[model samples]
Target: MAKGKGKTKGNGRSKQSPQNPPPPSQCETLEEDEIIRCGEPAADGPRCKVHQAQYRTLYAKYKAAGKVVDETKAGMEMPSKEHIAQYSNLHSTLEKARRIRKYLEAIRVEKAGRDMHQKRFFAKADDGHKIRLKVLEKQMSAAVEILDAVQARAFDLHMADDPAREWVKNFQAAPLSTNDEEFFSAINSLESETDPQRDIMKQQRVAAAATTNDDTMDADLIDIEMRAKKASLLYVFEFVTSEEATLQCMREFLGPENANIGAKSSLSYHTLCQYYRRIVMHDPVLSLKAINKRRMHVQFEVLMDKRMDFGLLLWKDSIIEAMAITRSKAGTAANVGDPKNRFKVLGGWVFNTPHSGTMSNETWGTLLETLAPIEANIENRFVRLCNTFDDLITYLSFGALGLFPPPRFCSKTDAQGRDAVAPRNHLSLCGCSVNYNFLYLGHHPLRDEAGPQGASYGLKWRNGLTYLELFEMSPMHLQMHSYPDSGQDLIYFQVVLYSDTDSKDKFECFGSGNEALPAIQTRTFEGPPASVTNLPSGRGEWEVQLSASDLLFGTKQPEPGYLTLLTRPGSSGWFFHFKKMPVKYFVILDTVPHRHHSILAKHVAWTALCTHGFGEGEYSNRKYARASDVMFQKRAEELLSWKPKGSWTATKMGD
Candidate 1:
């Protein structure tokens, strides 16, 4: 074997191999000097004959100076696998630090002692250093204890015991006249459940703050004082900014993906509206709900809602719960079948493959352009489109029916060329979740109907269709081939149909026209959910409310460390366990989203290479997952090893 491309990734060597050559068709935010691109028009091209000497001179000059040097020299550079790995590790550490900092700031946890932690601590005491240091140490001690069994406060190297151990003493709750239990409860929950030392400190303060004559502390007055003293406008500002940053991250990362191209514009525009709509909320960062109607396009809506952990006080709590579900048995599986058919035909939305986060906007755009309904290049584009269609269906479910009132403002009637989100009635009510448009076919009666007669018509529509009969349907022969063999091959699918309302029997639906279609084994547990009363129906939408847990995490048991959360947010403040991140960080992600898997590949690979005790600065191709492709297979678990693919030498998992 030619020592495949990954073998020499990080030995401080660089060669032009297809795998490691300049990343193709993707957008990257990089320091100007660190990028290397291939194939551009001479004038537009980098390092071409016309600009070679100048390019070399500029590069050499920049390198000698040791800075980003310039910003205009475009395209990403190729680094030795070692360099990439090292940089990735640094980034991961910084990210964790950032997350921790945000958590502290959210809860008013800051460094107490002289310049110890950053100024972002909980409260400012006259004995500031002592009080803050104690709090920091207490939290650190708790975390370190979880890392092992030792409950010793001195378990951490950074957190040393100070003579002033009594400082982390006063987290408390005063009565609120507003009776907004949520806000008050949120504060008390964290305060009461903290370490005993912290609790004891609080009690001592309460006794001191108490009036000797009254014998009761004026908690309300004291609480108001604390709010005024501890409240930060900058914190609120950054919260909104971070939300926008996150939305932009998804838009720039996931929007270009093939998996999201289905209601491409709808999702994007909806999210855009949300972003602008929230431009001036609570403290004015985002409360601008009225956006220009024209700007709210379908594709833009795709970026709107994401993780609700944004401004939450219990950010760690929510994610920890989600982590449990993801790490549990049911989160992992190998169900690589046709994704689109899996959602529509099989009526299930579970993923089974590790994502390779490849963050390439240009490449995904090329793919999106390729998938466009042009008269010429339909076949080539549809192949990739069909394979990733399951992800698209998931998007429709979470974004369309899962949220209400539309993600954005779209009041105009139908037009000639412009496209928007389908009328809500066009949505699908699958076994449990709601979807839009049948993923398997474009054919439907009058575009929207949930009535029994419409259901009967739907049966008739597919009854004689040949494409419905096969387990595997080729995208190329979609309309050309007739029923039976025309239905393609559906042997890989498994579909179930739940009623609009409840009942004991959940009816099983298949790709019409044949028995060969994959069978979605019906369940005795989940009765028919979407039951209908009217035999004739019009365009009325369906909505389903999901628990925070359901969207935040997946089920546990039967499969440990297996999570299949993968959906695009369709509205504001949306939070669904997303697919395409690592098993360690996030449980839900694309089995083969977009090119959605690309983000997973890049980030996970980045984290693994940088963290996990890997050698100094070595990265592997295996660490870099591509959102455009599904990469899980035999020995796939080995990819979890911390070292770069080229340098790793360890016993694989599940051996």
Candidate 2:
């Protein structure tokens, strides 16, 4: 009976029950006017999936437009005219604020460029230019203030929670302080609405996707290739000898024509070696022995009673050679034998060396003391000096050094004795170069023909004074000089010291009691009753005195120390360090103009003094010096000894 009841599967159709619902037929979406319904077949909801998605999009649009949606009819209400107007006004206000901020940023960037130009060129802004800049800054400030006010108003009206709104709220609440740091920090902390959006996560994902396995493998292969190249016998040989590399570098420096000339003559290698020797000799630190050998000549006076210094001799020779070259090119009949020509030649050398170019004021004074008296004919000597100086400048421009003469020096007397005007195409040397004029040293201030109009320049020199001399002079005195154009003088001395070992502290009472401190100390001395003394020279000399206690470490004897003499004439000054200070008294003599020559000379001299002992002293006995040399030699030999059939060995080379 049960089997008969189960077998009643007539037509294979199920009844429309609660569990087995009937399939949907038509979509339940209404039109915009809510007059017609969408009659599309529904796949999963009251409407078809496509119609359901469109309904959700409309709902979102209505919500964003601040309008209510009628869910029963699936329709959105139209916005009022007043609401549309308000939305437009808000959008326009935000856009205006953003534009104002952008314009202000552009102005700031332009102002920064102008400021940099002024600083770089040492150019002062005119009154009108300064006023215009101030006006621009004020206008930008006003625009920013207006934008901030507008943003505040928008926040108040809308009461919306956004980055911009929140920033405005915090900005208004922040306290105004006189402290610039606090005020700036508060402003920086506030987020800007117009800032560019940064999608860091998306960027990181994109970068990761771009770096494929092939790219990684390529980078690894490149690294492997480089290592293999470095380990090759050919590379090892090139690195060790470097003859071809040196020749190539010299060829690059000398130009192709010059290099080819040397190569044709079979002197390329010899020329390169000569160049290497000259460079090594010119080196201030490495060529201490060479400098010392020259110094011995000075002590012995091997050439004459008053032979020129090594640099001066080299300069004289170079000038003579330059003159010869000039004469050959011009086909001039004049010889160096004539008295006038001889005087001119001497004057040229005098003007150019130890005074012209970048020579130091101190060196200039020393040179003048020796050569000024040689000009016996005072009347015509000045004229001859000018003529020769002009000639030397011309030679330098076209010959060695390739210096550009100033405009004032370009004016000359023609063969007919008439004033000859030359083209003023070249830029004059700056104030720094002209400052070294020998005529400005008070001896002949009126003779400064190269000096630029309305440009003020001065020079100062300080002698290397010893510790004993410094100790003897007490209660240091400084003469207060008034500079109408420049700012007040900031004169102070700084003493810096470092201990060789940690056990001996260079500084005492660095921190609180029993605190371990670093073995370095710096002390600045300024004002009266501390570093200066009353021992004044007749020429308004300001004396600076330092006692043994002031400079020394406790009761320790006088050890090797460097003394830096810094004498500034106009705001900025340069210092030269003396390894051994032995002058009786420190002298700050005011003079006029010089440039880079003396600074370089002093640097070289100091380097020579500091490094000369290392070659023959106990320090050279250290293991690193000899051991490193042997290790390098052995490594080179091993690399060179490599063969196609032999196994590598790590045998040490004997000393």
Candidate 3:
């Protein structure tokens, strides 16, 4: 009976294993609290369990004793000496470590609190600007908390129909009240939920583009290299040097906006990007090799001809450079009733004789005498300043290479030319690839005059998208604004782009002009891209050459004409007697197709793996600054040779 009792207790009653002890009997009890306090196993527990809680409390005490967990969760997690030993032997004295940890924990707590406080303060103070935690952890925590609350409340917001959506439906800032007397207030910009349908469509399109073939990219590059020189010849410009590195600057030049460019350029980065994306999604093939890089630094110098090997001499060299001429009344010269300062344009600069010919002091003097009568005060003065005008001078000759022009389409014809392009009609498109590009330098501008009659040049000019009329030997009348404006100042100028030829060609003016004679210049001084000369190089006779400033045979006329004048000096004087003769103006007089019109039309075209405009039929159409910046990420040409073998480099998480 005794043996049976022991067997039942050990096997049936408890089933105790060799490494285990028998279960506690009903009559027996344990002091779990005492067991933990003694640094022993829990009185009763499932092996891995810490049921007593005393050990846990004691275990963390090491770090607490070290003074690590005085403030933050992170502080509490700081390992004790025992933990450090886990990594590798620290071999430091325990007491010293404890002291150091204590100090570190104090700093951590103080910094966390300070950061949190700063975030709230900044958020409240800023007028709608978003503040991100640059280096403060406490601030980020506070911001995260606020974001959480905002998001929760945001979802509960009602639809436009709901009455609870009072603020959103009636979306208006409260008027200043006499009692409240509040001067200003800011409100959050409400955003509606995105359409799932649109999201799905976007995903499908992206997937489709990913799978599409991209043979065009290779063809385009190969064609560009082989034909780069040929196109320059048609414009009478010789192919000079080429630089691949210069073409890469488009990365920074990127912005999100497709350049809606209103008469007044008042738009934020976000808005600009939105607008740009609607039309311009991608960049085009650009080459910036020909432009002088140091021209801006060396405003005056002399250069030698590469072909002729002669000194490009300088005779005063006052080439008319009319880019950013400030128009001014010298202080309210106009509207004497309210005489305020007026900033106006002086006009584009001319090289030698303004056109391409030699203008001696005497011949130029007579010409200026004729021009001054029809000129504004500023322009007349500007013209007189050109007594020593000459193109013989160049910065390149005098060891001053100016800032190179931004990457531009250093175009050359393919085997075929723009004219050689096959018409799209009859379901067969032209194999000839002809392209035209313009750098619409989007400069910020402001108009001070409340209701003045005068007009500003860059402030208001035709920004065409299509190459409907790229070549400009003829005079085409263009209104100052995109959409025609009514009333007052009418602009008319006799534009002799260059005497390339064809006196029979008449300029058909486009955009706002009420006069019966809608045409402007009576010439089509062809400044076609180098593409014209890049025809098939059959045998030795077909070498490719292209240039913007290429000199053609038998004609001293500049292919693009002289430094053409969009306007002369910002003159305050006004003359109703319209006349723009002798003073040649080079206005971009064609409407180019927007990105949307082109991109969507070629729905089946496969885009290359390359970013930006390296892909085929690439549309640089962007709407915001951020989007444009993002598009520029993979702009390298070597993308063709790259493989996706490695993962993205690790980046710091956004605080």
Candidate 4:
């Protein structure tokens, strides 16, 4: 103890080593304008965690203001995670609104039920229910108003961006028709700045118009524009080197450079054609010879005879007769006189391309003028008689076998007390119901009613040609017409065997080569169908020969919805239902067969009643039962051998 006390004397100024200077104040740095700071020092760094967080937030805010960094600026900093999130919030609101609209649409059952119930309640006429129904209806109306307002706002918001405007502009420039492909393969080609939110907005656009009917035409046009934009984008991507190249081509083709072109000159069509030309010219994979031989390049022809080649399928008189008969049979009053058959054609015509000079100059000139704009950029532009490959195949179907001659112009009243209007187009028949080339081959029922307008592009060919031509003049046309590739058995193979052009789509044909082509065969039945004494049940034999795979219920169970068949005017389109069900039903769409009857008839009253749950009225309920109380009834001795094994088994059936 004594020694320790003495050793403390050397640096006796309370030599506690200054008590190891107190640790730096355990507090965060105070902000410039703030008096107080965080109480504890941060585990890592000069400032406490709270102050660190505060600084990061402030830095992020400064960055989000889009302020660029400058070395000279003393307080410049990067944005914090929080600031980045805050900036994205603007777009997120729009996305959320889109999602909400989608959800609302998806929940349609609730809305439908509400509407139906409200209507029912209103019909009750009771004071209480009436008041409640009125309230509900008002609420629904208000809701619809709010929804419409929101949709308009969303559309405006989307259009505020440059990318959206560009998309819309291109879409409006080119539109797809009802006959065009339903889907565009190139919708995803262009990358837009606001693409992250595009999907939601797109759904909103379609859904907003889902319930609207008054603006149906405008909506349909908008839809067509959208589809065309997608198709154009894809077409450009595939054929053109880049979008810039496409734009350049479009500008050259559509601008004032082609002042002689018609006012109806199509920008999208030219863009596509130019792109094809560019690729064919530059790409080694393509050849002019090959392109010339393609279906689009070659012409198609159908041999016409008095009895074998009807220009169209359904004769106008026949359709009228059928409609009258059907109505009469259905217990409706109608004129019972027989319809005079005006059709006079009978055999399948040969299919081949015509030689040069075989087609008239008027035809060539018209084709050149009509298609020059479309084929201006092709390597070997030519107007083949088959205008489009589809015309050849479509014109020679069932109804066309009975071709009729065009009516003569009559100034005086005819035997029927009706004066005939002057013939306008090339078609000989009064009308056709389901002719594929109806637009090209026949007179439009309304032709006389319409003023002297130009014929549609499809019907511009001269009388000498069997097929329509779609191209203008080109070097290849001269060669094709001169050589006129023939003896190639066009029936067996889809394409001409003379060239290397590939099929535009997959087609099915029997056999393999030239040998297969020779072996291929077809059977035809002349005259009326065989008559039968007793008809079988359940639509025994179908008029159309559709494969089982084509049927709606071919291999599946019964579905909730009905199937649709796309029937043409003159063709007796058929559908086969292979699966047997407990009950069978039928619906018929009838068209009037007169000159002014071109307007498709709509079953308005029936449709309205069916929609309101008053479907087809009740039919008679049979009262007959088996004489024997037993489940099975005895058959005649002669028919005993034809008896079924069980309830599910049945006798053979066909008409």
Candidate 5:
């Protein structure tokens, strides 16, 4: 009986009754007062497991919030610290609640997944289950309340703490008046507050945008008045000298400077030539003949000879000053426009002379009469100035003489001389290289005095794909530009070279031998005209050399002539000139192919060939503003061996 009693008690059966007493209030809810905050289930003991877990979580969050408030309060002032501490505590509490809510939600998800996997979706849970879920709901509710309180507190604190933030926060939310006038007034106040110069800045921005398209930005508003003067040929001379390192190099190579040039001494042509030959093997007289046509177009040999030299000895300084003034004009002046107030010399001196274009016998006589009485550094100044001009030529020429002229062709005996070359059978497919973009034969009325009344054409070479070829062709283009302008109704199309012996510039028009009449044949065109009374006109492509020879000798026998445009005779005149025409290109051409040669060297040679044809001998056929070529050549030749000082050297240039 005793064992049975003990066993029953151990089994938790009531001692008084054998039947179960409604399970002895299995849930604490049945025994606890309705007023108790949590109705714990008896299975979970005196504490409600769900509510107990929530209490622990809330207590932990409260402790963490208190700690954070304490730490933040350590660095603040009394008033601010108090206020912020309160807010911080509230924020931490709210954060803790959020974490608890998330944890409970995760628990719910785990329960749901377990129930689904176990197929217990329809299983009935006891009051304990209900209480657990209810506790979670209550926790979420409390967390939300704390969150709301925290946010309200933080907002109040922020409003009192940060004015700028507060202003930004309320700006958009501030109410506007319903009245139109009040509304506009409020808007204006806000606008001014945001930007004091709102209207002005807006106007400025609009104006600036408008000016973006103004052309003035691309142009200079102030005009720069130009003083007419020549570009210093000294630079060109320097380039040539630099290429050969003329003076210093020669001095080093020859062991000593030629006392004749290095020191102030009267230098004759032969002596100067010797000095130059010894230095860099250059000759000034020959160099003058080469580039004289375009620069210093005067006979140096004749002017410097004996009696002429005597005349210069009397008026050398004046001539030097005159030449210096002329060079300063850089080809801008049509003629020496009244030499007075025109030329500036060393020592701030000024003088006058005859117009450069009127350098005739009459002008020379007048200049001599005016300058003979005046005394100056006649010999020294003249030599110095002439040397300067020579230096320019030598540098520009790059220390070289003329190229080999084609051998002369004797058709009668089929013998060729070193002076000239005949065309190997004139090909119908002849093509001349040009350096222009396009050739245009445009016409403008004479009544319209808008500059030149001539055609503008280009000489662009084709299919060379090289800069050297382009450079070689530039002279040709310059020649075309330099050619004499065809007068009104007169177009000088084809430039032909004839013997000076031909009185009328006439030749056989047709036929190969005696039967042939005067005619112009090119790579593409042929015409003397059906009748002699017609202006040449028609589209035709012709091959012509853009070279020195072409400039010196026109389309003549032995040497090949340039191909050109022509017109038929007896037709409605193409250009409408009622007389014969003289066609010429001021620049010369070399028939030898330069594509395989050094362009720089070739240009140097070319520069040493063309001269102003005032007379016969190479040097005597020209005019010079300074002293003799002898002095000039001496200086130029010295420059050939010139070396840069120290270790520094010059960077070379090309054209």
Candidate 6:
């Protein structure tokens, strides 16, 4: 019996040994994959050692929340109340962020639409419109700030493995919901218990409870509160610089006498300076100098290097003195009702004319007599006092000598000088490349009342015969000739057609003969001077050339016979008037060898050609119309290559 018992005990020991172990107990705790239970051996509770500790933690959370967790029935897979709360909070935050983001996006779309509409129609928004837009912009900025904070909070609370936390992770990875209906639908589904289709909503009532809690805190006011809290130095700066604040301060500084000065009223720089000294400089929180220094330091960090001792901080008196100097430099005399007083207040130093004392009484009287009409029309008395009348006469004389005449077109002729008739229209004529160079001299006959009526000298004045006579003469010969005896001094001017041809022929022609041409036929003057030897010659000459294409067919065509008047002194009065003459016959010569001359010619030509015609009911051909001489000259000068005021090397060497 002892031997039989020993064999049984050996078999039992063998069954319990490692190689032949009995069935092990499995943990009832769920795995991270929820569907799979923990396969490790059960320890303290119905879970592995790790999950047993988790269940204790969860049970403790329930106890803290005043809920009894039956320790016997508590499962390790059940989430703690704290985790559930955190998950709810995270979901609420993410939803709030999404709503705020969508709201901001809607605001952006609206603003963009407004901007696009305004741009398309060239419409300007009124003050009320502008204010509304600014308010919306501030709201957007505030919304963005709130959204950022909410997203940060969501990220912090989104560490759990709950559905809410999972939703937050997906929200972070996905783009903000742009569709309003979709976003609202999602929120509604999450909040309502009636929706059984959503797996996340079916899990628990935590999200719904969180949604109810969110209603108590107005999300709309969150941005406003955040904006109020973030009012810092930058906000203070902006407030001080605001138009209303600046105007209010100005009004106060000006005292009760200037209280009527509204926003639209012009404020003088001196007044602004006074306000700055009295209010801004003395303010406890802000200093202009300090602000400027800080701004500079922020912009250029190298300026703040320890080794560099930049004397950015200056004495208050020095700053005040600098401001005073700026105010003085920028000062302008107030409008005076009295003309003489206005002139005296605004006039600079004046010097007497070179012939002031030397001229005869009669000559000076004639000059002054001639200037009476000019001075009477001048609005600025200071200009009249500054020898502006003399300057006017001198400028008109010089400009007339340099005036470029308008182009005049002629029928294209074959190699044998036979006229070739082609279909003629503005486009067809302007497109023709064939062109000829000719000198044009314009003359206005002196009135019979002023001088003896001279004979026509065998020239037909109606057929532009005088122009033909001038065209036949070489440029050198024309340059040597004097002014026409019968011509008015003010109306006489000369122009030369610019050409690149160096062939023996002085009149260079451009393009092939087969091109379409204008219909106008011209004939040179078929008369002669009574005595060619006695004709006026050897007068000062200045040549101006115009391209036919630019004068007639450019973006802005000069009006036919459009005459510009000289209202201002030192104006390009004659040039402006000459360029708009009805004469035709000119074309562009692109292959010209002298590029600079060609460019200068085109620049001057275009400047005159592009002058805006007087508006409807305005007299463009009036004798005293206003013309911008400075504008014309400025345009011409701009075409030339830019040159430094002084040699760069010499400037660097302090020469």
RMSD of each: 32.9, 35.6, 31.4, 34.1, 36.9, 29.2
Give me the candidate number with maximum TM-score: 1
* Best candidate according to lDDT: 6
Mark the 10 consecutive residues where model 1 has the least summed lDDT.
473-482
Give the higher-lDDT candidate: 3 or 6: 6
Winner on TM-score (1 vs 3): 1
Give the alpha carbon lDDT tens digit for every residue of 134-234 in model 5.
65455434433443334444444433553333432333132111232343344344335423343454334443434322122231111100000011112
List candidate 4 stretches off by more than 4 Å.
1-126, 159-423, 426-655
The positional error of residue 574 in candidate 3, measured at the CA in angstroms, is: 26
CA lDDT scores, all candidates in order: 0.26, 0.29, 0.23, 0.26, 0.28, 0.30
lDDT of 4 at 608: 21
Question: Residue-wise lDDT of candidate 2 within 398-454, one digit each (tens)?
Answer: 211111222222233335542211111110000001111111122222223211222
Cα displacement (Å) at residue 376, model 2: 36
lDDT of 1: 0.26
Summarize candidate 6's per-residue lDDT along 1-655 as a digit string, tens digits.
6665645544365646677767667877554323666677877655567655544443333233222112211322222334433555755656665665566655554444344223322235688656756765675565555554555455445445533344333323422222333433443443353334333422332333223221222222222222332232122222123546445445555554653455212332222222232222222112212222312111111111111111111111122222333335443322212223211100111011111112222222223322233321111221121122233222222222222111222232335542211111111111112122211111211111211224445534432213221111111011101113211111111222222222212332324242212212122323323344443232233222222222232232222211112223454322222121112223332223212222223222222323333112322322111222333333224321132233111101011
- lDDT for model 4, please: 0.26
Worst 10 residues of 4 by lDDT: 472-481
Candidate 3 error regions (>4 Å): 1-16, 19-655
Per-structure clash totals for the candidates: 111, 10, 79, 23, 63, 16
Query: How do all models score by TM-score?
Result: 0.19, 0.15, 0.16, 0.17, 0.16, 0.17
In terms of lDDT, model 6 sits at 0.30
Backbone clashes counted, model 6: 16
